[model samples]
Target: MNPMAAMKAYAAVQGGGMPTGGAAPAAAPGFGEMLQNVMGDMTKQTRAAETQMTGAIQGQSNMIDVVTSVSSAEASLETVIAVRDQVIQAYQEIMRMPI
Candidate 1:
């Protein structure tokens, strides 16, 4: 998947919608909502990959399709992990801030 398209999809799933010329009126999604969205996306990608692999095993899908799906799922998983790490680091930094 194209990185820009992936980013746009992520933003949309986070309740921000795709960026427009004007600023979006919606408030940013809460941490829980963001986490849920990310998890949901990961689940979808994983399922798709699994389905594609199963089809390939049954000789109903192309090997290239299976490979693409698996790669997309892997990328999605990595993106989630990276985002999770960033969120944790931000929380730790915030906790260390003098109030």
Candidate 2:
């Protein structure tokens, strides 16, 4: 997945899920599911980029296309890392709160 698509999906998952002030729908996925989806997408993008790189090395894929794919994969990776860091920070903050 491209960075934009990944980011959009992230936003959709993060957006105020419960309609207005009502309870969230039972069909809504939990945080774990959202994180899993992001990780899966990231892995897919990385794999595609790797395949492009391999093709380029074999003189089959265009160098420009390979570069673009690799850059997109890198951006998506950075986005995922940033999200992971945010989640970890949030967890640490919650752990410090008095019960």
Backbone clashes in each candidate structure, one number apiece? Answer: 0, 0
Task: Give candidate 1 regions above 4 Å deviation.
Answer: 1-28
Error of 2 at 33 (Å): 1.1
On TM-score, the leading prediction is 2
Q: What TM-score against the true fold does each predicted structure earn? A: 0.71, 0.77
lDDT of 2 by residue, 1-99 (tens): 564766767676677455665666445567788778878888888898999999999999999999988887888789888988998999999999999
> Which pairs of residues clash in candidate 2, taking residues 3 or more apart in a chain or in different chains?
none
- Model 2 TM-score relative to the real fold: 0.77
Which lDDT tens digits does candidate 1 get at residues 1-99? Answer: 437546855675676556667876677767587578767878888999999999999999999999998998899898888888998999999999999
Worst 10 residues of 2 by lDDT: 20-29
